[model samples]
Target: MQIGVDPGSRYTGISLFTGSDAVSPKPVAEPAVVRAGVFSIEVQHRGNQIREKLTARAALRRGRRSRNLRYRQPRFDNRTRSVGWLAPSLRHRVETTMSWISRLQRWAPVAALHVERVAFDTQLLQDPEIAGRGYQQGTLHGYELREYLLEKWQRKCAYCGVSGVPLNLDHIRPRSRGGSDRASNLTLACISCNQTKGNQPVEVFLAGRPEMLARILAQVRKPLRDAAAVSSTRWALWKSLTVTGLPVHVASGGRTKYNRHRTNTPKSHTLDALHVGVVDEVTGWPVRVLVATATGRGTYTRTRTDRYGFPRLRLPRTKLHHGFQTGDLVRAVVRTGANQGTHVGRVAVRSTGRFNIRTATGLVQGIGHRYVRLLQRGDGWTYSRQPEQQPA
Candidate 1:
């Protein structure tokens, strides 16, 4: 068995397969995909929350120290970050991907691992037309970034297309939302257009003008944050996979694309993962993908804190209540209650023995514990299935 991992910042696609024809003399059937799906995580949002808490904590400390409350030596250089230290959220991405790989290995007779070295090649995607030309800096022709934007955008507002007006460089994705300062994310916008679209994502701002939206985005690079996240975590993920002692075969994004195009495979996260290595033919993939999202084992803090860090609400120290812990997948068979019938989902436990089951349709609350039966113990992930993507 072999595994192909198409690692992304937000969603890492993984496929477990068995290569059939590699050792066969005659033409054998295609590789069989035992399982495939994305491992999802909200890296940016989680990182932001961590940074916010650190900043708030520092502010509170500075406030008290400078208030003449106590005389303490200034120790600004007391600590230093070790080499290769990634932020908590980005680090989580690497750790979680590794954790799932270990789980997958247990389920299959995995022999080798084919992992993409990098998710995107900046040079290849600057322009769709510039393919095979070996263009590095795109179609700038030695002009500056701002000048390039002005000319590329035809000196007009990309959103409104109002020419002959004072135009400002706008971010298709706002900086606050983790957008980068790269040229691809930059565009020309008039003063009115800029303000009207202030801090709002380009997609939401141009919802009414989809044609205009598509035109602007076509010139833009893939979302900068996602690219950055994948780039930052790629090396770390690759390094972790090496310790597994499998013959880890690294592949480039271009090779994955080439294999996918040659095989006429439909574009999907799981499919991309399946096509990540050197291959002649591709087939026999499962129709359904098992989407495993990393929800994390519940937080360590039992007390909810406010902005000032004061405990807003305190809960029982124990996470498990009434023999059911929060996040346990369960089936509730209620014979007589407002939430009658059967419901299957992750449960939110309550001390009163009345839990809430979040199912696919909706939340069924006030479910008695006696009616609930544990289906699977939640190990910090939620699972679902979706049909494989079809070709356009």
Candidate 2:
């Protein structure tokens, strides 16, 4: 026997087919002794067993409980400070629905279950307006339901028994023609097989696997025809939660700030400053000393500002002792933002302003010249004016 079970939001439908051999019962060889004497009995118990086995197997294979599960909606809105209290009520509705399905499954052990997948973009669920409108709780989309079945059935292609690659939710009755989104009209299919099937009917596509097709259809139809109603506890809990509104929670974190600053001044320049020069195209060699001056604070050497005004320090030399030497303590300013304060660290190396510096926290590595001040004597020469390191 073949069956097709359609489970829907409002009602479920079941269809079954009796095999040719089982259409009529065969006469039993042994007759029961009765007061009425000779009596004829028609029986085909073995045929029934075969049909039951197929039916049960199909049902077990389609053991998908839910489809396309998404993240739960947060209870509190950060912008509006508004609380969402409708989740509990909607939850109650889902609970009731699930309970009803459980009852049906319990009573119809021989009936197979088929759930149609739905196609809906879940990303839209993230929008508060859309979610609040109640679209999230609707029936699972066709693709989602098919994915659910594939997952529930352990990713084994119902027809080929192949596994691993993702399966597609195929329409028993191709949707391109006129198949509605219903449980009886869907099944799991491998990607290649699904593509080959295209919009073809299930019967046409499964011609090579007639028995499997028959069994799958029979399962879909039988549950609608013979299943008894049963309730689900999970549904009850969900319904209760929906009525009380989803749990609302709010959380926050602290923010930290950073900054850097730099300037150029020389004692030779008079205080009156007859002419103030604006930074006309601040361009220089990759390795250049950025100096900053403070009125009462004396003079401070800082690294050049990056194209974005952010301090970018580069190491000038690597072999420091006699050659820019390592472990040389240098002063620099933070030119990144509002903080624009003085920050100091020791150089671990002197290579293209690239080096490692040991700080109170630990060894700060890859120290760049933009983050350090070069010690110079006169005529822009350091120590003996011998260039020891090259710019990276």
lDDT of all predictions:
0.73, 0.37
Q: For residues 1-392, write the lDDT of model 2, one tens digit per residue.
A: 22222222222222221212222233763332111101111111122333455575557444432232554555566555344232332333343333433443444432221111121122332242454445334332233344335433445765677886677777778888899766556567788878888888878878888898887677556533211111222223334333433331111000000000011211111100100111111111112211111111111324545676456884332244334444455654556653344545455554455655544445555545565674431121111111111212
Q: What's model 1's lDDT at 31?
A: 48
Clashes of each: 0, 67
lDDT for each residue of candidate 1 in 58-159, tens digit (9 for 90 to 100): 896898789887789988886889987887777887887788789878977888888887644454345534543433343322233453465457678888
In lDDT terms, how accurate is model 1? 0.73
Write down the TM-score of every candidate. Answer: 0.67, 0.25
Measured with C-alpha atoms, the lDDT of residue 261 in candidate 1 is: 71
Instruction: State which candidate has the highest TM-score.
Output: 1
The number of clashing residue pairs in model 2 is 67
| Candidate 2 off by > 4 Å | 1-155, 222-231, 236-392
**Cα lDDT for residue 355, model 1?**
94
